[model samples]
Target: MPTHLIIHGRVQGVFYRDWTVSTARRLGVSGWVRNLPDGTVEAHLEGSPDAVEAMIGKMRDGPPAARVERIERSEAKAQGAEGFKRR
Candidate 1:
């Protein structure tokens, strides 16, 4: 499954991107994550259904310092992304 996610709350300075990258890679997911200008974190995750769902669950908590309020999820087209990255 390929998904687009927008995470809200204290995610910008909390190493969320780094954590997402590592976690996604570990899960055999491929995509990119970036901090949006609107104080949100946006990511494109593409992999197996289990991996994508697991990633979304992890994003809910984020890192130790992160305070995730909510996540907006939607369907996304597969990009055949090579590796997870911070964009």
Candidate 2:
């Protein structure tokens, strides 16, 4: 199943999005992550269930500089993501 996540907290300007993209690509996951105007980071990932879960876990703990507060996730339809992107 595909997974969609909306992460909130101090997750911007600290290389959060860039780190996420790198991690996702390394995991061979297809999706995109972007910075929201509300200071939150939203990402959509599609791959093996286990891989997606692992990515979510990493997102919760992000990079050393990231202070993730909460991450909301749910199942979503895959749109055939081209690659991990920033926006």
Candidate 3:
């Protein structure tokens, strides 16, 4: 299964996307992350259930500079992405 997440709060310009890519790749999760115009970060994570859940937890904390206020997640079909990316 895949998980889609919307991370809100001081996430932009705080290396959130870069951190997400590094964390997801380190966890061997395949997905894409991007910044939304609404100042939120969005991501699609796909991997083993454990890895996906781990990534979600990481998203909540984000980088040291990120002040993660909240995170929203939902299930989605896996897209077979080969690696984590920032879009």
RMSD of each: 0.6, 0.9, 0.6
Stretches of candidate 2 off by over 4 Å are none
Higher-ranked by lDDT: 1 or 2: 1
lDDT of 2 by residue, 1-87 (tens): 788888988889899999999999998888999988889988989888888888898999999899999998888999898778887
lDDT of 1 by residue, 1-87 (tens): 889999999999888999999999999899999989999999999988999899899889989999999999999999999999999
Candidate 3 clashing pairs, residues 3+ apart or interchain? none
Distance from true location, Cα of 6 in model 2, Å: 1.0
Residue 48, model 3: Cα distance from true site in angstroms: 0.1
lDDT of 3 by residue, 1-87 (tens): 898899999999999999999999999999999999999999999999999999898888999999999899889888989999999
Q: What are the lDDT figures for the candidates, one per model?
A: 0.94, 0.89, 0.93
Residue 1 miss distance in model 3 (angstroms)? 1.6
* Per-prediction TM-score to the true structure, in the order listed: 0.97, 0.94, 0.97
The better-scoring model by TM-score among 2 and 3 is 3
Model 3 bad stretches (over 4 Å): none
In candidate 3, position 11 carries an lDDT of 99
